[model samples]
Target chain A: MSTGGGEAEFEAALREAFERRGREAPAAAGLLEAVLARRRRQTRHRVAGAAVATALVAAGTLLGAQLLRGGEPAGPAAGVPAPGIFAAEEIELCLLPGGGDPAEVLLSAEVGGEEVQTAISEPAGDAFRLHVERAPGYTVRLDVLRGSVAGEPLDGARDVRAGDRPGRIGDAPGGGRVLLLETGTEGVLLRLTAEGTGPGDAELLAWAAKITVSTGRDACES
Target chain B: MEFDDYVLTRGDALLRFAHVLCNDAQRAEDLVQEALVRCHRRWRRIEHGGLDAYVRKAILRQYLSWRRRRSAEEGPAGDLPCAGGAPDQGIEAIGERDAMWRLLAGLPRRQRAVLVLRYYEDLPDAEIAGLLNCSAATVRVHAARGLARLRRHPELTGRAEVVEDA
Candidate 1:
């Protein structure tokens, strides 16, 4: 996995994957246009204090510079929205391994944002997110349970000042960095910034603290 | 790099990238059309900077930055086109390719883009850094992690990327 000197085999394999995907997936002029339209309208986060790419990225899905105050995500909140309501037809969710079972889960939501999208995936999946981004910039991601500071359950979840002060969240008691982040649909954001850490390290810690996961329910669709 | 020329020349590449990111045809078109309009809006600034490169950077970044809409986001009645078997399955192995995309859809954003630029777009680390606004090392990290995961994929078993030991 070393991104070192000329590795044709590795590079070729990468190309092959995309080529294979392109051929398998239907290709049309309009599909490209949809991506264009979406990308054009998406917003960018203004990054401060170098060391990372501070782009807000895609609508309400903005990346923040906050460090995980420290801890893991709280246990699933009860009386939460059904996983089905979260599922969308056209949208697919790629669940990467952050020390969890089903190593990787690739799921598609049903589109309406009312139903939850669900699907199982093989373990040993890698890191990368390839899918359409259509969520608005101002969404209040209401997860019944856990969402680490690293995770973006609530769209953008930043920009607007938090009406309620930031507090602690995590299920496993006694000092984990998990907290149930809550914000209105107006782009209230939460970010975990691991001070004096690299992006990868920070991301790992963040995932540990905040990864929206479903341990009990296998699959659901509304 | 004028807006007019970009639409004419690099539009195809943009469309192609959009298609890959989205895995759907019609949606890809709408994405590009919107990207084109935005590019045209900033045509003057882009021409001075580097039209194709700017548009490309913007497009890729935009793709990453936009709010992710799930299939559910499409109206209750309207669904994002579902993936179906291609008619030309005989000509091309559709399932295999779909498997690859399915695999890709599982990854996080930065890793996906890094892989796209390094392998698909064939841009070096420095250029990728320029595009992603990160250090060269970060780009290398992303490329490495992304490739490692790709190699682990079974379909990619004989694709010539995985080392025997790897």
Candidate 2:
């Protein structure tokens, strides 16, 4: 037989087979309900995922705004402690123990072009730290007295050369160390106290020595 | 028209069409159900167009792609039971129809789909190509190859080539 006849005859047979099937069709039954339920489930998942993502993004934005608004810097700079820890809490005079005589403020330091009153006070160690709050870092306590005090030798004091001046490094009553420097007529004591880490003794001593002291009258005296 | 009304009316015909595409009654039900579910999900967008044609295309796609699923890789030739509710046609006619079904099932699924679309559905070559997502030439080739294979079935064609009536 020719290809054309084969095509027509096979086609006829296929049609007959389908006609046999056309007699019985399955019921629609619950097909629509099943499909609609599937659609609803997909919609719920999509909406829930979108909602969670949106909530996360909004929370992140709010947290970022709050951090920016707070005076503390976002993160610590390289090799530096976090700024919030080191920032000064209060800037006031470091008064003496009796309050009758202030530690002779050799020269007041200028913070923002205004001379900030500087006095030396020996409070109970904890109060000393709380009252003498500077920026958020270790407080660099510098005391330059008019003359050396005749007191018992400080405990745990070790001899060290701070620049040309021979000084003794001793642990303070609180959690930091102090450097005692006697330069003939005037004596300087440097101490640093903070909640966390502080600068090395050599660094603090150097910082204490470099206090740009002016031989002017004390601001508290005026 | 509402989706419920449309399905209620046209669902039976679509099921029959799916049965012709895939001989298994259960598979046909699944195919039609999946297609209608997809249509319902996108009803707002597809409601403006002819929903019947859209659903027919979806059913054709589902049938075509069904073979790829490992679960759907069933041997169509093995399960050749006669469908329920046969017409008053004699047993000889039923045997001939079953013979035709086995012959048709032995062919490649794409070629069988081409035959079903062309002969059973009375679709033109171009229309079948659109439903199959192929070129008209490809449809014709599949049809020719499928018919050639069907003629080779010894029991159905009596070991003789089928001849077209002039």
Candidate 3:
């Protein structure tokens, strides 16, 4: 082929390749279903978030009024620990694609207070595990799962509250306590597992209160 | 048009366009899904006309700004399967086409996008610039650079020389 002819042939090949690839695109089956499902989830989250915000505002207003009136503020209520007592660190975990089945750890830090030594974050299938070693034998493991609860049953799970977040506390199989808290992000939950006999409900609740989970707004944001 | 009807009718075409833009099946689906989700929210306002154009623009913008999770060392997935038979149907012709496809894959995202829009979509430079949110001059520059890179490949040039000798 002449040079001009060769160039023309190359262009034709490129165009033809694009056309073929376009034809080879897979059927967009379940696309509408997926979009609708996502929209529903987002709507649910927005409603729940609005409710929580309204409740917080009301409670804050009541407490402020009492304090301004010179009335003694109520002591720490049982089960509901005082907020901001523990130095909480917000850890942002970026969820992987495909429903974030296997999330990537964007950040990790010392959770709870100085009593907790260090936090080790690892990507577990369908869950992001954050291991906090309180002492030699006492380790607190928190697994963040996106979009669903862990395999543990919620039948006998007790309702627990950490700050404004509501969750369920249950006994983990194989001898441990598990606290599942709903991370503010839609469909993301933090499964706090207390392995070893060292920490009980009090310690677990404290740790849960101190640690905050945030879905990072970068990689999967779009 | 109703959202469901629109999706059922044009969803396949959007998927194909996204596939051409991103060159990855999974990523293409994601791009289309995201664009549809955004459009679904405002379908009431845009349903009368230009809805297809709106969704296509959304897909293109997302593809351009997408931060790939994979490490930089990894390249895009391999090229799509062979389209069909070429005119010459010779070994050299096949080699050149394959080499050109790989070179196209390696171009910078913007340049690749420019070439795809100009050639595959048969868009003018101004239209492509409007989609890409850049000036027509910039679109021309990207297309020129991309075509120049493809033309300079040794495999294409050498294979052309071989075909000429024959």
Candidate achieving the largest TM-score? 3
The residue-level lDDT of candidate 1 at A2 comes to: 39
Candidate numbers sorted by TM-score from highest down: 3, 2, 1
Q: Least lDDT summed over 10 consecutive residues: which range in candidate 2 chain B?
A: B73-82
Error of 1 at A36 (Å): 12
Model 3 chain A poorest 10 in a row by lDDT: A110-119
TM-score of chain B of each: 0.75, 0.81, 0.75
Q: Please compute DockQ, using alpha carbons, for every candidate against the native two-chain complex.
A: 0.15, 0.16, 0.17
Q: In angstroms, give how far residue B12 of model 1 lies from its true place.
A: 1.6
Question: Quick one: ranking by DockQ, best first?
Answer: 3, 2, 1
Compute the DockQ of candidate 1.
0.15
Model 1, A1-222: lDDT tens per residue?
334432665565558666655544433334434444444444221123111222212111221223332243322331122122222212233433334322334444333312243333432222122222222321122222123344533322222211132333332232222223332212222222211111222222222222232322222111
CA lDDT of each candidate? Answer: 0.44, 0.55, 0.61
Model 2 C-alpha lDDT per residue in residues A54-113, reported as the tens digit of each score? 454344334333432243433331133212212221122322323333333322332321
Where does model 1 exceed 4 Å of error?
A1-7, A20-222, B69-92, B158-166
